[model samples]
Target: MRRPTIKDVAADCGVSKATVSLVLRDSPQVGQVTKQRVRESMARLGYVYNRRAADMRSQRSQTLGLVVTHLRNPYFAELTMAIEDAATKSGYTLFQGFSRDEVPQQRRLLETMAEHRIDGLILLPAHDSRPEDLLETVGAGQLAHVLITRSVRGYECDYVGADNVRSGVLLGEHLGALEVSTVAFLGGAEGSSARRDRIEGLGSGLRRSGVTSPLALSLPAIGDEGGIPLVDRMLERIPCPDAIVAYNDMYAFGIMNGLRARGIVPGRDVAVASFDDVPDAAFQQPPLTSAAGHPEIVGAQATRLLLDRFEDPDRVPSTVLIEPELIPRSSTTSWSGRA
Candidate 1:
């Protein structure tokens, strides 16, 4: 029996061969409805796209690689999905790797992707990553690359990330307005640039609001489980802080749980705010107040930057910093400072 081809799919969908080709490539030129119809036809006819043959003819793999710090973090998960969506629209397949914020693991992932010959790469640098780690593959231009979420020290590379300092300032100002005398920052890795920037901005905002000093603590781990023990330690301090700012929503959620275990109410007794207003932030027990990092924007922009790099390899590298918005919620409201 003869094998199904693009022509057979085109004829079945009542579209031109060119149109069928466009659909196969997932071109933006094709309307969604038409793409859906063409896909249906292809499925019904068992038409398979010969991507390898296409790559051979184009001398390109039409694939992009993405390496994220932590997929368990909701923010990175959403960011990855957004990048995939953008890549698919541009006729590129996206390959993903999670480094778990380990420099060695991240380096391994980059080499593996280069071995696979992906056309481009987008990376969220792991904690404590140095420029040398990326200079070999990404800096040497073996593959087009864009850095997202975090940038490596001394690496002059294209980057897209949230304006973390501004996000921290916003959160700090919000907490200050509540007339809280003391603030404690919890969670996140100590080596993370984003964490440092957030702390700086938080302290600046707190000082501007007449709050003298802010306490900061970096957890060995950053998720909810790690956050549970943090509350007790903070409470042990002289005149326990009146509010808490978490590195991310997960920390805030865990801290809230810890607070409840000790019969401390979140909003009324001690306000809680966090960064990365992930999907679950709103539905938490007291609806967390958080900075909307907009991971989708970061992901989409990172993909766009990488695509542009492919078009003009010699163009000057660029950096994009998306400003964050504060989402006020029940968790940070109705605060009555400690007695």
Candidate 2:
């Protein structure tokens, strides 16, 4: 069977190929009557408009690319969903890829998006990716790229994320109000802006409440695996911390599992608090107390920012910092603090 071509639609609509092309592209220049006629002809002839071919001819792809460090992480999942929703509303489709925290994979995905001529990209860079070329290529190609959940220093680009430092500070204050002396900090990885800001904020909050030189710990970047070992080591210490502040809810969950294995009940033996109030946090045995990172707002705002750049390439880069809110649940109910 022969495939129907644009010329067939043109002939059936009694219009030129150019008119049919414009109508297929949904160009506003085509009158409503003409667009309706061309569409009706296409439907009648079973002629499908080739978007890829049209994009190749026009040198403009209408697709958006989204790359994240870990899709398994609920926070990233929420963000991706929001971005997809906004892209659909704006007549654009999204192509998503995950790096699994691998820098090489991230670079490969970036190249793929570029090769496909994706209109824009939203990236949550890998924890170890510090390449200057990454930003250079984005700037040189004039691609609209927005950083979500993470930001690179000295890069002039649009970014949307929570105030990690403030979140940490709030957590520290909460612990201090509970008079939780000898607190410990378990974090994602060193050299990550998110980790640095969170630790700094937590330290400041603890200091302001008269806790000096609180024992801070940095776990290996092996996600959940690192959390168990770190907690085991902490248990061996003579004077264990009465309260544990984790980098995120995943780490907190790991800690809870480790404690359970040691016959220690979390929220009772030792209070635990973490950030990023992912859905699973609420369903945990004792329900994790955490800082709400608002992934949906971050995702929606980042998508909007990138689209704005697409509309006006000359627009100035912007930064959006969302405030984190503390959710107190059973995890810290036993502690001496306001419920």
Candidate 3:
């Protein structure tokens, strides 16, 4: 018995092999009805795509290389999974790496992927990645790349993330509604674009509500381990602060733990809020008040952007900032400012 090929699928569906190839690549150029017919023909005829052979002929690997700066944070974990699901469903392969928010390590991993001929790259920039560093390392025209969550030195490229500033605004409004006048914004590093936008949004919201400027406390970056020590440092400021707005829900969880260690009860003694309503945010000791980044949506959108760039590399770059939603819960909304 002989194996059925892309040509067989094309013939069965009465379309040009070029069209069949596009369908196999999940190219958006093909119409839905035709896509369905081609898919059905492939299934019926048991046609298998020779991706490796195709790669050899085209000199392009059908693989996307992904580097997420932090992996232990469940938010990034969820985001990575979403990208994987979208990539697999679209018939592309992915190679994922964690840079642990280190610039040299991220550059090394990305260079290694490029050396292997990865067709594209998806990156969550490290704490100190310059746009020029990336273009220099990978070569501007070498691969179709997309920036996710954080942009690098404001260089234009396919990018997607929750509106951080808007999310900060959402958190501030929630705190103001709770009559919080002096909250401390905790966690994200000083120079992160995401953190800057968040601080801007939060400041704007707090000021509009007659609240004073928030104590902008900085951490090293967004990850698993900085919340407790950072929040402790925030406690040393002149004013004890009305509430705490963490960089993300993971940090909020740590703040809650830290508060408990200090013989203070969160949500009752001081309110708490943060961004990225990751799944665990709700199930915390007291459900968290947070802004939803919709990692699932943002992740899917990032994947589509990269895949589209693969299909049409010359298209103008796009930046998609998904709006965030505030989830008010016991951790902040119910705080009475005393335990």
Candidate 4:
């Protein structure tokens, strides 16, 4: 027997194929009587709707892609889960990829997603990504996209992320109140907007307490292996840094490891703080002090923004910023001693 299609269901129900298609899509515009008849006919005929064929007809892929810089980082891992949860709840099947902190990889992943005809995208661009690069790969406003985490230099689009500047300021204030004099900011070498805002916030917050300048130790990478060189250079060059502000918990962990090897425990000597209070931050040997970005909330916001854009493409672009909270822990001050 031949396979059943919308046409078959329509004929059996004595209705038009358009009505069957509307019912298949769960469109609310169809009347209740017609909707019931179409579903009944589909059940009687064992008609299965082909989503791919319907997508082709409507020029919609029925898929959305999410691309972030690196999933190895716990912050991104948590953020990804939140996005996935929100996307699934909104009835979307997602395509996810990472750029591996490489520009070519970012371009390739985006181009591939575009080829798959993704209806929209949420991007956490790599350091090397530029507005022109994105425009070339995805086309100029062709694929509805939202820039999350970090916005590209010249690409004006919807964005959602934690307030990096305020987070930095809050972290800095935590350290400043603890009387940290000589501090250093490690990792985050790339010239992304988030990096710039964070650095400025740290400076602004610390300056209020008479700590005018902070030594910026820009590292090429923020992995555990890279932490050793960063520690070595910091110790040799500025041995008296009272505190260290790492880019994220992942970097803070690496720095802590490096400090321990040099007989400098984090809580007792040379305090450390981080952003994105990841799962491990709370359980580290000396719990890491951090600014909580609430990655899940940010992810959910991004998902909502993307979904909203899909509904109203002509809507004006918007930016959503969530402020982070400073979570004090053993890494910055003695866990038990802190009042």
- Most TM-score-accurate candidate: 3
lDDT of 3 by residue, 1-339 (tens): 999876688679897555676787678867899999999999999887787866753666668888998777789999999999877766568999988888889889888998888878889988678878788766464678888899877577888999998898888777777777677778886668888888889988887776775554544444445778776777785445678888888788888998898887888888988889988999997899899999899888888787766655688999999999988899986788633
lDDT string, candidate 2, 231-331, tens digits: 87776754456788888898888888877888877888788999999999999989999999999999888887877675456878899999999998888
Error of 2 at 192 (Å): 1.6
- Which residue runs of candidate 3 sit more than 4 Å off their true CA positions? 1-58, 139-141, 216-225
Q: All candidates' lDDT scores? A: 0.83, 0.81, 0.81, 0.79
**Which tens-of-lDDT digit does each residue in 1-339 have in candidate 1?**
788876688679897655676676677878999999999998898887787856653787889999997777899899999999988877789999988788899889999999998988999998788888788766675578999988777888899999999999898888878877777888888778888888888888887777776554433344324678888777675444688898889888889999999898888888999999999999998899999999999998898788766645788989899999999997888677633
Highest lDDT against the true fold, candidate? 1
**Model with the higher lDDT, candidate 2 or 4:** 2
TM-score between candidate 2 and the true structure: 0.80
Q: Model 3, poorest ten-residue lDDT window?
A: 215-224
Error of 4 at 88 (Å): 1.4
Better of 3 and 4 by TM-score: 3
Per-residue lDDT tens digits of candidate 4, residues 1-339? 999876678789896554566677787667799889989988899888786776764776657899998788888988899988877765567999988767899999999998888878988888768889888877474788888888777777898999999998997787778777777877764577777777778878888766766544544454334555678777776664788888778778888999889988788777888888988899998998999989899998898787766545688889999989989988888722234
Using all chains and alpha carbons, the TM-scores for the candidates as numbered come to 0.81, 0.80, 0.83, 0.80
Candidate 1: regions farther than 4 A off: 1-57, 216-225, 236-239
Give the CA lDDT, 0 to 100, for residue 189 in model 1: 81
| By TM-score: ranked, best first | 3, 1, 4, 2
- Stretches of model 4 off by over 4 angstroms after superposition: 1-58, 139-141, 216-225, 335-339
